[model samples]
Target: MDFNNSYRVDLREMNFLLWEQFDIEKNLLDPTVNAEYNKDFIQQLLFHARDFAYNELGPNYQRADREGCKLLDDGTVQLPSKYQGIWQKYTDAQWGRLSSPQHYDGLSSPYIVAQMIYEVFQGADPSFMVYSGFCAPAMYLIERFATAEVKQCFSHKLATNEWTACLCMTEPQAGSDVGAITTKAIPQDDGSYHIEGGKIFISAGMHELTDNIVYLLLARVEGARPGTTGLSCFVVPRYDLQHDGSLIDNHVRCVRLEDKMGIHGCATAQLSFGDNGPCKAFLLGDRENIGLRQLSSMMHMARISTGIYALGLAGRAYMSAAEYAENRVQGTSFKEAFNPRAKKVSIMAHIDVRRMLLEMKSKVEGCRALIHKLTFHQSWLTNLQALETLHPEKSEQYQALSKHHESLVHLLTPIVKAYTSDQAWRVAELAIQVYGGHGYIKDHPVEQIARDVKILSIWEGTSFIQSADLMKDKLAMGRNSKLLVVYQDQVKTSIARNRKAGVLLVETDALELSLAIFVKTHALMGTWVKEQKLELIFSISTRFLEMMAEVTLSWLLLDGAVIAVQKLKNLEDSQDEAFYTGKIASAQFYVNNILPGVKSKAEIIAKEDTSALDATGDMFLQRTDLYGKQYF
Candidate 1:
């Protein structure tokens, strides 16, 4: 496949999801809420984003990976030769500030719209955007918790990409175990703290792309209690700012750069603070022992971003595979196999190949739908909050709706993160399968997409961690959380509405059955908690997460299918017809094929198999004897 051809998305599908399926214009694009973002303007924005992705970003995708990053003697890193120019163009376009608030010199477009645009850019070159991803989250932290002085010092530079920032949470000893972090922050006479510690696996940690790198370091303050609660977030910059805004070395050093399996263009650094001199920093908003709480907002946003990242890569991989299948002629149709005069046909004509394409198609679309729905809630909540301020007399009603949207967002975050990331890898793998040997080679983009997407499932919390969060926090292990209840009601309502319309009845029935099983499994897990059979619950938690995710995806796809069913009536263009037809087919494929796994999973969960827990460590080994014996 052509390299430039690798980065494309079905804009019609995106438009359908944005307009027909979700109908964001009713509230999100309301003149009162977003006056400038009419349908035409949004469409134009998407077109421009698509063009930029293909013309500018797509060409650099493979180059960035191959050239990678180089650590210099002065602690700064050298990026790909083309990266500085691309980065300049990207930042100059102000694309990074689309979703930012107005005070930060941003366009302040709806989050959904901004994310859609971001999906296009990220799909083109995920590695390049890694430098820009955490900047917004760090800016959000500063905007929300930093004092006016600190905000003035850092917010604009981050928002405008004049400088870059990173969230420093992981240490040598602490990954998911945030409470065990031992990085220390000592108080100074002038109300500043000297940070002393090391952070590993920090993306964009050391680079010359921006003037100064800001570290949102999390460290335990001196004399503070132990554990995560005692930690405080600090604004530690590589270069400290004087009263006149002159920069001075703060002794932040990039000790080493990690050589990773993928996304090699991104500089993932092991950083040391105050090794040579004091790393002076100010506490965020004069607060103490609320670092975890402060970082929670950023973490949530990052999780959602992870889903979008996965969706972009998966969508690209699926598109590439679909195109390759249509163009690559390898075999004759089975009916023509015995005929000497029969001509060879494209792989798309083969049944198994078509099945593989459909599987990839269904999953990529399902993941996109899931992420779009999550962002839609985010946009709706933002709109409602604005409405609350605009019309105080109806504030109570708006607040209630806002609470409902908030609950949905909370419920969907982990599902989007885990399910989409896991499926991205699967989709890319299938895309490669569709291309045969060509995909496994570096000549194809699908192979690189697979490598880049694997990190999504690992970082921003692993799939297992997300599952545990879903089960324990989102679902409420002791009982059903209000969040879970709200989500179930939404899925149930979607099923009922589709059934009443007599549209997608088969799909709705599948979803309803899976949902029933999913709910009961939750209750069963709750009982396991009561009986102190915790190991069984933990062992099966990831499976349980997948079950719920499948049910959710099935319902959402069916929901979109219902809309497509109605829209197909007047679609004059053959292309539009095919698009709507694909929506219906995607729904059917997922419900008939993938959704049944929920039932199987529930049965597996009910079995309460403890063999995994019961097996000894030695049982996992391949040795046939106790000592150095011969292996089979």
Candidate 2:
């Protein structure tokens, strides 16, 4: 029941990502920080997070899922009794405001720390984590754009975990396509607006733990334009409080709960607005047309969080598999030896199992480092004053750099969300494989991990949706010339550095051939885009994204290696020596084994395989009919 212990391995990995890999301690020591922050503080925070997750929330995760939430006819949703205590503990610990500003009762921890803590909580019980994570973003929106009075009225309560928050964006007619929403907001005599219509898939829509629930409602104003352009965001609370701040039931009504594939402990509710009457709602931001834009500010953060969640889940899967492999005894042979001169040995002895486990470890750890690095950059942008003091003459340069990185973050968000989730599922699947028969049974954690991770790819956005976004929006953003130039410089610099090191893994001929293929593919993409060959561009974008991911990961590993080699030379202990040696090995693993795939993809892209698009409904029907159910 102790989720903290369950995520102990992940905590270690996260620490490495933040401190050893990203060097967040240096960033925290910048002059802009009001109080000195160091590794000790981070360690303490992590310790607290582990304790809170394990002692408070971990025990109730399975219970919450089993009991789920109940919606009474009186418009109240009751959660499991266990959740009440856990919720109280969470708030009392002041964890809700860990990343918020100090003036607002927040600890103002760095994003990497927040992310690490978040991983601990999420890995413990993502169902409960969803409520707090969702609420944090909503509070952030109000803090950033809401009026002073509004902030005074709600910010403190939300930050203190007295009030819960929900993002109400999806309606019956609209899911991922937010622009098609038809919820209406009529201007009232007061500054508030009267909200009507309903929304679906509202997580934490009706929970009993918090006194008040703040809903970030997206609605179309009366006589306004259609689609996302006419939409506006509103702060609609579940209850109308008195002058003294006592709760009275308001117009927000919970119609029903969604029966989902996973995360059943988290309430996904169907909500009706103005059911009993009109709901008074306050507008967010000044511009009515900025609804989508405003929502995006929070969405990006959510997307990043989702990516973190995926990483956590994947980490859990990897740990579960690794632990099982070390303990489970299965077969006997020179090939599948469980023990020396014994009939059975641990699954870890098997080469195939080891390969899968190592693959999972490499990807999960690599992605963890990447996510933490991105979070550090985001924190740097938010705390620009500190950056300015550190690089006075280059203050503007840092600002521009921050903006460029933000674009890169936006570009990579979908991939992180989509690809990480997808890969996590693979990890879970491999975990099941490693467990053999035990993995499929309900008694083991592998089944649960697999089921839990399955939802990640579907949530935030589907993988295909992410693919389209990467191609249509991210890759095609601005002139893309600048981005391309930046990418080329990076690849060139990496190649040059590796060549200088004289530690190249790939054959010189192979490296040159791969580089040529990449260049040709890049040129082809440019020509296709110029000719408005949308289909051709779309067809190759996923491959291009993969190619780019390979290149970026390769660069990161090489960077790690460069540092590791320097450290190894000075280190005397075997453990330290192994650590640095592993870094070098991991880099080599990526470059030698993974980088070759880029050439294969490049060749495919060059060939322009559009056979799938060419297939018609009749052809698909005929194929299915001929194949029949038995074929599947």
Candidate 3:
């Protein structure tokens, strides 16, 4: 693949989402929150982002991959030569500060704009974007949880790209199991702790992109309890600062780099702490044993980021495949297949190829809409915060208004991470199928995209972990939470609006069927919860999440379709008309062609199959050879 092949973005769809579907102006244009970020200003930012993504990042995609990071002799991760220029371009633009707190001299940009910009960057060059993944979250957590001095010391540098950060959580035995981590933090009288242990598979863990590397390390303080509850978060820098703010070596060491299957441009490191000297680590605030709780709050943001990352890859793959299909003529059109004289037409003229294209297009669009909805919900809170800041007398009212939006964010986080990541891999597979033999080779981007996106589901947390959280927490539907009831009402409202618009009845009906299935399943689960059928609920949580996510996605897509229908009524036949028309087409395709799968999933869940659990050890084949095999 020519990595510089123009990365495509659906600007019209993005505009529709911002102005029509989500109504960003109503949600965020408060005199307190936005600094003159009106419609024109936002449009200009989007246009500027388009040029930057295409011109700056797109050209370096292949070069960055071809020259990935290497571990240097002095135990530092050295970035590819091409990335220095890319890093310089990124730092100069200061896009890294998009959503950080204003105290750090950050933009405090709205989540919608930042997320949309992220999509363009990811689409342009995901591998290159990997180096930037840690900046936003670090700034967020530090500003919120760190001591004032710590925040003053670190947040600005992180936001401004003067320094970089990495989160060191996983160890040999503690991947996803934070409680099992053995990293120990021993307190010293000088107000710093000594950190000792090792972490593996850490992305951007050790790199020379900046002057100093700040590590958000999780470790068990001496005498603390076991599990995540025992864990405490710390800020451990690779090079400690002196009284005058000069750099000095700390005990942080980059032990080695992992040989990964994908994302070669990213340096996945194994870090060993307190090996050479005192690894001074500062406790986040003055608190202990609350690190897990504080960190859990940021997990949703990370998950949402992963979802957008998935959409960017899926969108790029689908568009590339579409371009390939339009030009690669192989077989005659189905109507003329029997005629010997019939000329070979573009593969897009074939019905099967068209089906594949629509499948990819609908999924890419659906995931995009889903992610945007999640951000839109979060934006309500962002605006509310500004309102509270501006009108301190009405702070309580603003807080009350934001409560439900907060619940929705909690509910949607896992779905966004799991569903989008899972589907991105499938979309990449289909893109490869669209390209046939050529796609299987390294000559195309789809194959590399496939490898890159596969890790998304595995990282952050696996699909099963997300499903468990959804079932065990969100499905509890606590008396105070509006997650279930409010979401159901939102879906009903969208269905009604779409029907009133008088368009795409078949698709709306299909979506209604999926919603109906979900309603039935929800009631069934409520009864099971009341009856205390824990086994049955746990057994089917994964399917339940899938059913709910698919229904939610259908609702969002149909909402866009309704907006498109209204827009098409006023526009003349032109590029704008075609754009609106395509929105309806993709929306209808997903509801009719893909929504039925929800019914099947719901039916399977209703069956409560337990044969897999019922099986005895003797009934399953045991691999004696595998058991006997050993590694030294």
Which candidate number would show the highest lDDT if scored against the true structure? 1
Q: Write the per-residue lDDT of candidate 2 for residues 238-317, one digit (tens) a residue.
A: 88766897877778999999887667778889999997887888888666767777877788788788878888778878
Model 2 steric clash pairs:
338-345
TM-score, per-candidate, Cα-based: 0.97, 0.90, 0.95
Question: Model 2 lDDT vs. the true structure?
Answer: 0.74
lDDT of 1 by residue, 206-272 (tens): 8888889899989999889998789899999999988987999999999899999899889999999
Best by TM-score: 1
Candidate 2 residue runs with Cα over 4 Å from true position? 1-7, 333-343, 385-398, 477-479, 487-523, 572-585, 618-632
Residue 259 lDDT in candidate 2: 81
Q: What lDDT tens digits, residue by residue, belong to model 3 across residues 451-535?
A: 8888999888888889889877886621233477778888888888878878877788888888888878877777777777767
- Badly placed stretches (over 4 Å) of model 1 are 1-5, 621-632
TM-score of 2: 0.90
Q: For model 1, which pairs clash?
A: none
Arranged by lDDT with the best first, the candidates are 1, 3, 2
Clash pairs, model 3 backbone: 1-443
Q: How many residue pairs of model 3 clash at the backbone?
A: 1
lDDT of each: 0.88, 0.74, 0.83
TM-score of predicted structure 3: 0.95
